[model samples]
Target: MSLANVFSIAGSGMSAQSIRLNATSSNIANAETVSSSIDETYRARYPVFAHAMNDAQEEGSLFEDQPKAVGAGVQVMGVVESQEALQARYDPNHPMANEEGYVYYPNVNVVEQMADMISASRSFQTNVDVLNTAKSMMQKVLTLGQ
Candidate 1:
């Protein structure tokens, strides 16, 4: 792909990873939240992603083009809520306990959320590194022409 396209691809990747990291952090922060009923409990949130394609960069154009051509980067599909069941705990002294002395907690698993957070953070960092590398390569190419 062209040097300009490299920047676009890496920029989209970084944006998608940022959304993923934000969702993971949000899920972790609300993992321990308690509620009186299942409906009131927070559900784990996850960001979905899909590959984005742009037709404008199709090959076989009249002008010379990069051997490898990709129009854009990934796109975030959406944030989805997990359908896991809410956690229930028996605690008579709990302030939010129901009539049966049971409190409902979010379905979030701390261990899983922490792992997801780490993964997302790492992915984001990787994207940043890709952007940096692409930038440096582009700079070097520019210097070669000078």
Candidate 2:
């Protein structure tokens, strides 16, 4: 791939990591929220990402004389809610408690969400590093002609 493509790829990666971080933060924030009904209970949310390829870069090009397939970047598929069972805590005196004196809490695991946040943060930093390195290399290449 060309040096220009490197920047686009790294930028996409950073965007994806940012989305992941947002989802992790949202899950963490709602971890302790309680609901009276199962339907109203918050579930852990996570971001899904998919590989994106440029249309013109297809092997059997739709357009004539096109180059080989090149990865464009990553795209966020969507946010997925965890299917894990919600916590049913018996709190008879709680305002949000159900008729059975049970309160529903989100399935979010704070520790896991924090770990995911750290991972996303590191991934974003790595992408930033990649962009910086690419920019430095490109600058050096320009100096070669001088």
Model 2: per-residue Cα lDDT over 29-137, one tens digit each: 9999999999999999989999998755425746766556568999999999999999999999999999999999999999999999999999999999999999999
What's the count of clashing pairs in each model shown? Answer: 0, 0
Q: Write the per-residue lDDT of candidate 1 for residues 72-120, one digit (tens) a residue.
A: 7989999999998888999989999999999988888889978887887
Candidate 1, poorest ten consecutive residues by summed lDDT: 61-70
The lDDT of each candidate is 0.83, 0.92
Best by lDDT: 2
List the RMSD of every prediction in angstroms: 4.0, 3.1
The candidate maximizing TM-score is: 2
